[model samples]
Target: MRLGECRQLRVKDMDVERRQILARDGRGQKDRITLLPEKAVTILR
Candidate 1:
């Protein structure tokens, strides 16, 4: 994912239970979910 895409992610869009990140493009098209790494989750938390 791109830096801009990461920046666009909201806390509400995150699925902590599944440890995934739901993101969309700047245009709000093509939504996708990316699994977060354990280490990354720890840091984000």
Candidate 2:
């Protein structure tokens, strides 16, 4: 995800159980779902 997308992320965009991060309004003004690494998940929580 781009810096802008990351900045826009909220708790609602994260699914810790599924290990996913939803990147809204990404490149081309599109939405995408990306994997959330276990290491990152630990820190996020």
Candidate 3:
């Protein structure tokens, strides 16, 4: 996702506390939460 989009994501929309990324698809028709790897999360932080 783009930085702008990421910024638009709210804390409630995130599953970070659960080690996941809740994202909407390009068409905005689908939503899902995907697991994030520990290393990637550390780097992003």
Q: Which ten residues in a row have the lowest lDDT in candidate 1?
A: 22-31
lDDT of 2 by residue, 1-45 (tens): 789999999999999999999999998999999999999999978
Where's the lowest-lDDT run of ten residues in candidate 2? 36-45
Q: Candidate 3 overall Cα lDDT vs. reference?
A: 0.63
Q: What is the Cα-based TM-score of model 1?
A: 0.69
The candidate that achieves the highest TM-score relative to the unseen native structure = 2
Arrange candidates by lDDT, descending: 2, 1, 3
Report the C-alpha lDDT of model 1 over 1-45, residue by residue, as the tens digit. 768878987888777778888878744567887887888778877
Cα deviation at 23, candidate 1, in Å, is: 0.9
Cα TM-score of candidate 2: 0.85
Residue 5 lDDT in candidate 2: 94
How many clashes show up in model 3? 0
> Against the true structure, whose lDDT is highest?
2
Which regions of candidate 1 fall more than 4 Å away from where they truly are? Answer: 26-28
Evaluate candidate 3 by giving its C-alpha RMSD to the native, one decimal.
Answer: 3.6
How far in Å is the alpha carbon of 35 misplaced in model 1?
0.7
- Name the candidate, 1 or 2, with the larger TM-score value: 2
